[model samples]
Target: MLTISRTLSLPESELVERFLRADGPGGQHVNRTESAVELRFDVAHSPTLPEAVRERLLARRDRRLTDDGVLVIQGRRFLRPGAQSR
Candidate 1:
């Protein structure tokens, strides 16, 4: 389960994750590693989300939303060797 807040939590089944190759530095090695994560969440028919929250999410004009009311999020992770933590 994914905890969004103190009173909100989403089940793991509602979230789908797909690993894909990321386009960035690392030359030839970049194509071999799947560092980019594509996350899909079905907001139209989720049992976890409340009706009001679902409606609000669907009402958004964000481009990440699809016609079927699915939210698509792309996560790109990049790590540099010998890089210091902020």
Candidate 2:
């Protein structure tokens, strides 16, 4: 969870997870597994985020989010299959 209220970045908390194929130097692991790097963020419901940040998120016309307002990012950029969850 990134804190736009006070910090430049934050870790994962209320993040939505997505697993997909990745392209990296993991030998056969790359082919047999998913390991790249991509993460999505949901601007809604974030804690203490700046108003401008919230507006930016709400401005995006992404359909990846659900009715509950959660954005999904495909994560495959790393040594594994999960996103960094930042």
Candidate 3:
């Protein structure tokens, strides 16, 4: 299960997490290991989400949101030479 808040939580089935290769200079490890996480949530079809929350989410103008009301979130972890990137 994925915890969204103290009162609201989403089920594991509703939240899909996929790992992909992160882009950056990290030697062969970067090419071999998938460090990027892609989280996909079906806001329009998820039964766990309330109607008001779903409507509000769909009403927002977000480029990550699809026409089908699926929210795609990509989190990348890349290695840099210094702390400048951080």
Candidate 4:
């Protein structure tokens, strides 16, 4: 389960995650490993979200929010093999 706040939590079943190969220039293993992550949350029909919160989230004008009320967040800043960490 994902805890959003003191009163809100989303079940694992309600969240969808996808891993993909990171884009852009990188080391040799970049194309071979799926280092990027995409997280999707369905706000329109989530049973855990309060109606007010759902409405507020959907009402926003964000590019990551789809017309179907699915919020998508992506992460791709993965450190390549043998690369030094900052």
lDDT string, candidate 3, 1-86, tens digits: 88888978999888899999888776757679898999999999999999999999999999999999999999987666664456
Q: What is the TM-score of each candidate against the true structure?
A: 0.85, 0.44, 0.83, 0.88
- After the best TM-score superposition of candidate 1, give how far the Cα of residue 70 lies from its true spot, in angstroms: 0.7
Cα lDDT tens digits, model 4, 22-53, are: 89866777689888999999999898889999
Q: Where does model 2 exceed 4 Å of error?
A: 1-7, 18-40, 76-86
Each model's lDDT comes to 0.89, 0.60, 0.89, 0.89
Give the clashing pairs for model 2. 1-11, 35-76, 36-76, 36-77, 36-78, 37-76, 37-77
Of the two candidates 1 and 4, the one with more favorable TM-score, higher being better, is 4
Instruction: State the RMSD for candidate 3.
Output: 3.4
**Candidate with best TM-score:** 4
Count: clashes, candidate 2: 7
Worst 10 residues of 1 by lDDT: 77-86
Q: Name model 1 segments beyond 4 Å from true.
A: 79-86
How far off is residue 69 in model 4, in Å? 0.7
What is the total number of backbone clashes in candidate 3?
A: 0
How far off is residue 83 in model 3, in Å?
Answer: 9.8
Pairs with steric clashes in candidate 1: none
Residues 1-86 of candidate 2 have per-residue lDDT tens digits of 55544555646765545556665566546577754444566567777456787777777787766556566665444544343333
Clash statistics: count for each candidate:
0, 7, 0, 0
Candidates 1 and 2: which is better by lDDT? 1
